[model samples]
Target chain A: MRVAAVVKRIAKQFKRDRRSLALMMIAPLFVLTLVWLVLDGDDYEPKMGYSEMPQPVIELLDEETQHLEQYKKEEAIDLMKDGELDAFISIEGMTPTTLLEGSEPSVNSAVMRVIQESLKSLKTNTQIEEPTINYLYGSGDMNLFDRVGPVLIGFFVFFFVFILGGISFLRERTQGTLAKLLSTPIKRWELVTGYVAGFGLFTIIQSVVIVAFSIYVLDMYMVGNFVELLVVTILLAITALSLATLLSSFAKNEFQIMQFIPIVIIPQVFFAGIFNLETLDRWIQILSQFMPLTYGAEALQQMMIKGAHIYDVWFEIMILFGFALVFFILNIRVLKKHRSL
Target chain B: MSFINVKHVSHAFGKEKVLEDINLTIEEGKIFGLLGPSGAGKTTLVNMMVGILSPDQGEITIDSTKVPSFDLMNITGYMAQSDALYQELSAKENLEFMGSIYGLKKSELKERIQHVMKTVNLLPHLDKPVEQYSGGMKRRLSLAAALLHQPKLLILDEPTVGIDPVLRKEIWEEFRELQQQGITIIVTTHVMDEADKCDELGLLRDGQLMAKGSPGELKEQHHASSIEEVFLTVGGVES
Candidate 1:
């Protein structure tokens, strides 16, 4: 009953502060929209610069997917360095040599695809074998966004809740409401529980909106049940909110709370299965176990990318729950600094 | 027995001793002022008595119960230097939030909120958000919140700091009325006039209590014409 008051008050405050409410929901949507536009834009067209190319091979290349231009060898290299050209092909004595600007992995792949397509038309007389492609999880139709969408969903929910919850808790200290609270008969655990329950309520709507947007609106992969996805999302949000409140005690103000994002949260994203951790040094790869987002991202990928059921991802769910518990206990313990009671 | 007792209490932040072997006793049903200049540890001492901070050495007891006790917190209403209000919340919501924490029932909470807002002359502004309140109005609103729980012991840390002389007088009058109804008020202030208004004053300087007595008695003992002169003489002798 006592906890209900704090929850109700926080909900009321959120209602009055429309800007923060919008930020919680809209910021993730805005980022998702940008990602959608960038990756789902028209297929990449390679700008192929040529010093001297056979007329037939050039004519065979699709006009829409390849931008063909003639240049001197030196000029081609210069244009490639300046990023105006994806690749340059120069033929000497029926041998084709292609120079590619390999700085961007996606662009390099696009350039190679175009080069292979153009060479296929000319190689009808020769015996050229094509390599077969196979996938363990996703088919060839999957886009880059489809592969990364689950992790991005986990990351956005974690990032926004961590920042907003941390700043609000820090404000409680800087504004002296913490002192006033400690002066009352309210136990330390009660305050911690109140904060988690309050922010937890708001995060319910937040997770639902974000998950629905990603699955239904943006057409990101959702191979698992929607209810299972929500369960993981809400637990992840609880972990984020609890961890933020625990860390807020170490900060003196809102800016200090924000400083945690780059140092604390950003590193989690890097280690949370977003990047390939197998190639990392052994000790560095082990660091992922300590980040709450690591477990969240792993479970989300299992559900969204691999089409794994709840039973398959149960271990990750347990770890996320464990993290939320530890952070919640730490938050209550940290409140002892304000009042021993 | 004294309602509140401090025996050989001392506290320090890191290596700096903010309070040293502080000993005090506050009788029930009286306005006891901790009069000191800024940074003289008035707020620190009040905070310790209210169980917000535990003394490093010695003990404090309220009504014979050791302080820093969760149960003791029930009877204490503390108003810190800052308003400590949720600026986004209306005055009524702020009052209701605090009232609920004290475990006041719905009817009692509503009545107390009305009575306290009326006491602070904030009844009209109860529906307005605290961020829209002026400095003095915020101070008054904080006082109303402190009083909402109907605490038996009210510990106010510089409650009248930003209030005008006229409103300050009115708040002191309210304190007097609360005392008549058997509430013990411990008000801390650097203002000399507010200190003189307290029934008894503890003159503090540099974390030490230089003297404790009624305003008239302290002035007569120091042979000073005003409370400011009395404070200077007492604080000067101790330091």
Candidate 2:
């Protein structure tokens, strides 16, 4: 009943702030939708200049990127130097060398992707030896969104839940109600548990809406059990909710809560399996173990992409629960600053 | 005999002692006021008395029993410096919540809610969310909530802050009326006029208790015309 009172009160408070409700429910879906569009772009048109081209090679280029007329090698080199061109193709003899004036890594990868895909498709049509395609979770058609969707799902649930839960608890300090609650008979852990249970209820709904939207509307990959996806998402929510309230003790206001996003949340983005962690420095990779999102990401990908059963990813579930437990305990300890009891 | 006892209570946050060598006793059925300015540690002392905060080097006993107990919590009502009402909820909902937490049943809860609302004169705006209420109205609602359980002891931290003078008087009258019914009200205030109204007052400055007595007794002792001058003289805080 006491927890109910806490739940009812927080729900009532959240109900009044339409902006927060919208941010929790709709913002995740909106971002996923944008990712769906940008990453799912079927054909990536890359700008290319030809230095010298064989008739067969010139025909191999896609209409979208083929600039085949006068194969002026010097002029093409100058354009690349001035950043006017993404890359240039030169066929001195039989083997073709791609001279790319690449500055940005992502742009370089993107250009490489388009050129390779076009070249392979063209080679297949010409009855030449075609490049072999092998996929683990997705085929060649799978875009970056599908690849990163698990991490994104884990990220958003962790992010919005953190911000919302942090700000809501922070408002208690801002609004002066936390001191009032401390004066009550409610024990410190009861306050922490009641908060976890209360916000946990709201987060369940937010997770459901956001996850369902990402899967159905954005059509992000989900090869695992729907129930497992829900499990990972809800666990991520618990971590977010607990970590937010715990860190909130250190923050004086909402802006300070936002400050945690970069220091606490953003680092997880790189380590949450959105990119290849193997390529990163070993120490940077170890930092992922500390982030709550890392476990959530691993669990989500295991379920959604690998189709691993609940038992297979049970360790991840336990780690996520551990993060939540530690955060919850820290939350109780932080209250000592307000009241020793 | 003392109804509430604090002995050699010293507290600090790290190196900075917020309350030091504090010894006090409160008589039963009395209107006791702790008067101190902001940062004078009035809140720190009250928190210890309520058992929310424990003294680092001492103890608090309420009604001859060691404090920070569930038994004490049920018997004592606390209204903190902050309003502590759920602003998204109606005043009535907030009262119901506070009442329920204190273990009040439905019939008694309803009766007490109405009585306290009327006591604080928030009965008219009982259904409106606290966010819509003015500052004074919110203060009144908080007072109403603190009165819901009919606890024998009531501890209020800055209870009349942000309250209009007219409504503050009415609330003080209610405190007196409750005191007549044998409720011990421990109120903290920085206002001189409010301090003068208490049956007994303690003047605190810089975490030290300067003096404690009935208003007239302190004034007579200090040979001062007003409680403020008596306080200033005792605290050595003239100006």
Candidate 3:
């Protein structure tokens, strides 16, 4: 009954605080939409300038390039330097030598892609052997969004839940409601459980919306069961919530709660499989094992990207749950600071 | 024996002591006030009685049950100095939340919520979110919440802090009514006028009890014209 009361109060408060509700539900969608626009938008169009190119190659370039111009070699170099041309092509010894203004990697890749594709047509006519490519995990067609979308999903859940849960619990302390709560017959653990159960309700709804939007609306990779994805997402959220509540004790106010994000939340992103950790220093990479988001992001990536089942990703899942349990106990112990019981 | 007993209780914050070795007894069915200045350990003492804080030395008991015990907490209502309310929730919702935590049944909670709100004269604004409430109204609402569980003992830390004089009088009247209903109330206040309304008063200063007696007895003992002068005489002569 007490848990239900706390849940009811939290739900009511969420209803009243529409801005926080919108932030939880809409902020991630807004960011994901922006990411989708930038990472998964229409194919990149590279501008090409040709000099001393064969007629057939020029025709291929004309068809592929949105901005194709024939320029003298000197003029092409000037245009490339001016950033007007993505690349300049010149055939040397029957080998197509392309000079690229290679500052932006995305633009450089696009220019190389156009050059390679246009050259492939030439290869088909020459009867030269073409090398084959294969992917072990994801297909060659995968974009940046598809690769990092799983990690991003886990990240948003952890980030938003952490901030909201920390601030609200901290408010309970600053506003004196926590002391009022302790004056009742409710056990300290019951208060912790109530907070978890209360905030857990919203976390469940939040993860559902965030995960569904990322997969269905934003078209992120979703090879695994939706339920399993939600399990990881919710567990990740529980870990965030418990960790936030435990850390809130050291914070005197909401701003101090926010201060924890830099020390606690941001570092997890580095090791959460967003960046390649293969060549990183061994000790630094081992730090991933300690961060809850590492396990959350890893398990989420396993399910969403690799189509793994519960048993396949159960190790990371258990670790995330273990982090939540430890923080939950710590939260209960922290309440001892307010009431010995 | 007194219904509430605080014996040799002392507390400190770091190296600074907040409550000395203080002993006091409060009878049941009386409106007892802890009269003191802002930092006279009134809040700290009341918090100990409500089981929110445990004294560093000695003990407090309510009806032979030691404080800081769960069962002891079950029957004690505490209204903190600050209005500890969920500002986003309506007054009724706040009452319902507190009532539920005290293990009140649905029907009983509803009935008690109505009764407490009426007692505090907040029945009309029960649906308004506490954020919209005036400071005085919020205090009264906190009082109503403290009364919601029908606790036998109510510890109010500066309950009338922001209340207007008329409403403050009405709240004191309600406290008297609650005392008549056999509830023991411990109120903390710095206002001498409010202190005079208590059935008995414990004058505290700098973590020590200066005097404990009926308001009339205290005034007569000090040979003072008012409770303020009585406080000055006791607090002055001792220092």
What are the per-residue Cα lDDT tens digits for candidate 1 across A268-289? 9888887879999898788888
lDDT of each residue in A1-341, candidate 3, tens digit only = 77777888888899999999998889988998898888897677889888777777778878778898888888988888888988888887878898888889988888888888777776566776767987767677778888888988889999999999999999998999999999998888888898899889988899999989998898887788999899999999999999999999899998899899889988898887888788898987899889998888888888877889989988998899899999999999989988998
i-RMSD of model 2 (Å, 1 decimal)? 1.9
Off by over 4 Å in 2: A47-52, A62-67, A74-136, B236-239
Write one digit per residue (lDDT tens) for candidate 2, span A39-97: 88765455677755555545556465634344477887887788777778776677767
lDDT of 2 by residue, B163-231 (tens): 888988988999999999999999999899998899999888889998999999999999898988997
What pairs collide in candidate 1? none
Model 3 off-target regions past 4 Å?
Answer: A91-98, A116-128, A132-136, B237-239
Quote each prediction's TM-score: 0.94, 0.91, 0.94
Ranking by lDDT: 3, 1, 2
lDDT to native, each model: 0.87, 0.83, 0.89
Q: Rank the candidates by DockQ, best first.
A: 3, 1, 2
Predicted model with the maximum lDDT: 3
lDDT of 1 at A300: 92
- Candidate number that wins on TM-score, 2 or 3: 3
- For model 3 the local lDDT of residue A195 reads 87
lDDT digits (tens) for residues B81-157 of candidate 3 = 88999999999889988988998999998999889999888899989999999999999999998888888999999
**Of the true interface contacts, what fraction does each candidate have?**
0.89, 0.52, 0.96
